[model samples]
Target chain A: MSLHDCRKAFSETLVALAEADPRIVAVANDSIGSSNLKEFKKRFPERMVNVGIAEQNMVGVGAGLANGGLIPFVCGASCFLTGRALEQVKVDCGYSRSNVKLCGMSSGVAYGELGPTHHSIEDLAWTRAIANLTVVVPADPAETSSALRAAAAYEGPVFLRLSRMPVPDIHPADYRFEFGRAPWLRRGSDVTLIANGTMVARALEAAALLEADGIKAAVVNMSSVRPLDREAILEAAVAGPILTVEEHTVVGGLGGAVAEVVVQSHPARMRLLGFPGEFAPTGSPEFLFEHFGLNPEGIRRAAAQLVEESARVAHETHPVR
Target chain B: MPPDSVPTDAAAESVSAAKMARRIRRSALQMVHAARLGHPGGDLSAADILAALYTAVLRIDPRNPRMPDRDRFILSKGHCSAALYSTLAEAGYFPREWLREYMKPLSLLNGHPDRNKVAGVEANTGPLGHGLPIGAGAAKAAKITGASWRTFVLTGDGELQEGSNWEAAMAAAQFGLDNLTVIVDRNRLQQGDETERTVGLEPLAERWRAFGWAAREVDGHDLEVLIRTLRAVPFEPGKPSCVIARTHKGRGVSFMEDRVEWHHRVPTAEELSQALKELGGGDE
Candidate 1:
């Protein structure tokens, strides 16, 4: 199996989509190389729009391109794309309901050494709040391709978060992607570890670690955050306690969205894990993940805690079972 | 330019424009008064021009608001939404009774336009400086498909101060969107201060011309002039048209004209009576 970065998967999948549909265009804020769009630029120069360092204009132009009968994949570093051009995304794309795909590359603490200014830990929270916008955080290279294809086919505005971290393939090559649907990777009656993007790899690793300690954990790759996987989430809650992990703020990102669904339906005990609502200090992405307790080991510890809590509650409620 | 010399057809369209202006003003006032909240000053300021576009100039169908071949009109300064909602309703996009729900919680006629909720609203534009670029894209789409549909966008003179508008302005010129027309309601007032004092657009006409648009100035309140100017669109081929319609911040209402305080401040009952009297035609 090829070890692929989500950025590479994003570019390759985009190139494939562009070949299949002539109306597909790539719009970047002078981050073609960063967004891994070199092959796309070479193959179809007219379809690649490099709008320099102007983030606001880049988003607006993407909306314009979409309105001009072309499906535009607007790509840029996550920080600038979401922060600088927030109003444009809200009005030009979300409000207009234009067929534009906003691809946020190198999200979360991926640019950790570049400081908090470069971090995009708040993107999910910000975009999920907007009505009529679809938000996706792909877990791995295969998921990246699936997400890209899904965004292309979806008829309205969508935000696709692609991580820079190198992750092993987690889904089959022929996996069919569906918008607003979560993929359940592992089925178990113990506890559920729900995650997306870079965190999914960590969550799968966490489930493996939990199994070594004689504990069973269900792993779910919750790629779609906006139109959350309600049925899957409810089932998971009913099966056991729930633990959500993501490379985002815990307030309004995937964790918050999942909690909203679970609380409404099942009302189960759950653990929310992510950036604990603060700007992280200067460090490498690995260091930040460890410091924030979001790596595999940390996830395993959190899942174990939830499992024990759920088992204790069940034992107290029904001693025979 | 002289008012009579302004090129307009003195036909049924012109008569409709006059009647439409009266209906729009009445509906806008009613909506604002019903909700007891709205930016009535600016709504009144842009009513006449919106009337001209809906009744006389723009090629749109109330029945098929989403028809790909129909002309598009985007209200860039979306805060003046009562005028837009009233104009759209009067033009038969939706029932006029819908105006009664304006600004009510969950009402389609929000403080700003929502394209999904309301018919005939080309784009959602509350946060200022967004409609032009979208309109430019619409025009470019028409060009791409070789369709004759045109795109019209209206922005407040104060709205041009937003940098996003300039970004769209540069792109519109770059694309040579000859089918796009941008109308500016130059009422010379912002919320708290005059537009000139806040951020001057004094050499505004020259600025747009430098940006490669065919620029013209006219009286915003003059229904006949507005009708003519909108029809004589794309004043120069291969360039987008910009009409700077000089207007009073609060036109028609006696107490509100040129008053910066009235930019969004609601009127009292006595004041509303005076305003209704000035707009003149009794209710049908």
Candidate 2:
């Protein structure tokens, strides 16, 4: 499979959408080169609003642009776009119901050397909590195009957390995206691995490893965090145990969403995996993933352990059905 | 601030003020009763000024809410939604009877002003400190388009504590948005307590002057003064305008006037009767 960064895919998809719809406008906070929006700005200068270094104004301006009958895709580094303008996003876009697309580039430690301040680990939790906002984390290039297309088609505010990390394309080029639904990658009876963003790739590797160890692991890519895929989660609960992983804090991220679903639906055995609610010490993105036990080998071990635990629980619940 | 000029008694001024104030109070009560659950106290507090604006000063069209040449009004402190809804209804943007479905699950009359949901609402603002920047942007839009559609925003006194407002203030002055007008509802009490105890803006007028705005102070309940001052917008050329309106928390309702507890408190049957009588809201 070809390798692609979701940020490049986002830029290309946005340009294509703009070509088709004149109402589509791109707004950046002095991040033309950083958000990969140089070509877009050059092509449509009138539609590009480059508000320099002012993230708060950038978000409010995006809302203003939307109010004026234009659909705005507000692009910037995830850390500043979600952190600096968080209140603006809540009030101007969410509360106001402005038709704005918040494109957060390089989320989840993608800026490897930029340290914790520049990393956007809390974006998922932050955007997910706001009412009337749809939070999306695209796993790879194909998912990125799908997410962008969905965001453009939807008539509401959306947050698209794009990654700068290069990843092998997991979904086929013809992947059709459905917002707020999980994409099932495999079918298994022992356990299910639900993930999004960069963690989906490692989840796939883990599933393969689990199969090698004579354990079948189901892999589900849960891209939308808000209107979660309750149906798929219920199916997984009925099938076997469920394990959730993400590139964010385990406390209130994807794992938390899965736990919420299981507690209400089938009440299956579950294991939540991610960064253990703490900032990672300085390291490369690859090093950090390994340190947090998010690599494929670690995920594989976690999946096996969950399967064994689920088997034990199933035996205790119904000795002989 | 025109050289600290004295108040003038222009012909037809007092009569116009009395008429506008009466209409605003009547409209505010009708909207709240229609919606069933809305912030009525703040609506009453800000009614006189909004009445002065729509009836006397602001240039707008009820039929064409999005006219390119029309002036813009942003209610920054949007929790007082009843006031805005009534103003727009009276302005003929929509049927006044539509206020019946306010706060209903499917109704567009949400708890806050949503520009997308409501006609004639320039910006959607429920949170404090969001209006000034948007109003600044609208003013900038006018400047860029070479249109003289002046932009006006009304904010709560307590809402100024948010740093975003100061940022917008600084930016507006920097851009010399002469088409921008900011009106502060200095109602003293916020959701909890008096703004002086919570966060004082005693030197408020000077603060605006320092920020390159032409500043003025007026009795918010005085419709005559509000109308007179609002009519003379952009008091100084090449500068934004800031009008500090001194108002009571609940201006017309005798028992509720200046009472901090009535911020969003639901009125009982007895209290509602007393308020209606105090407001002189009869069968019109």
Candidate 1: residue B22 Cα off by (Å)? 2.8
Candidate 1 lDDT by residue in tens digits, A76-163: 9998999999998888888889888999999999998999999999999899988789999988888888889988998999999888
Best by DockQ: 1
Q: Candidate 1: misplaced stretches above 4 Å?
A: A42-52, A57-70, A305-321, B1-15, B104-107, B210-212, B235-238
Q: How well is candidate 1 docked (DockQ)?
A: 0.40
> What tens-digit string does per-residue lDDT give for candidate 2 at B186-253?
88888989888988877999999998899999999887788778878889999999999999877888
Docking class of 2: acceptable
lDDT by residue (tens digit), candidate 1, B181-217: 9999999998878888998998999999999999999
lDDT of 2 by residue, A1-321 (tens): 556777788888889999999778887877999899988988877667666677887788677656655678999999999999999999888877878899998898888677899888888888888999998988989999998999999998999998888888899999988877899998888889999999999999999999999999899999988789899999999898888989888878888888988998799888888888888889999999888889999899898998888678768988986
Interface RMSD (Å), every candidate: 2.6, 2.7
Cα lDDT listed for each candidate: 0.85, 0.83
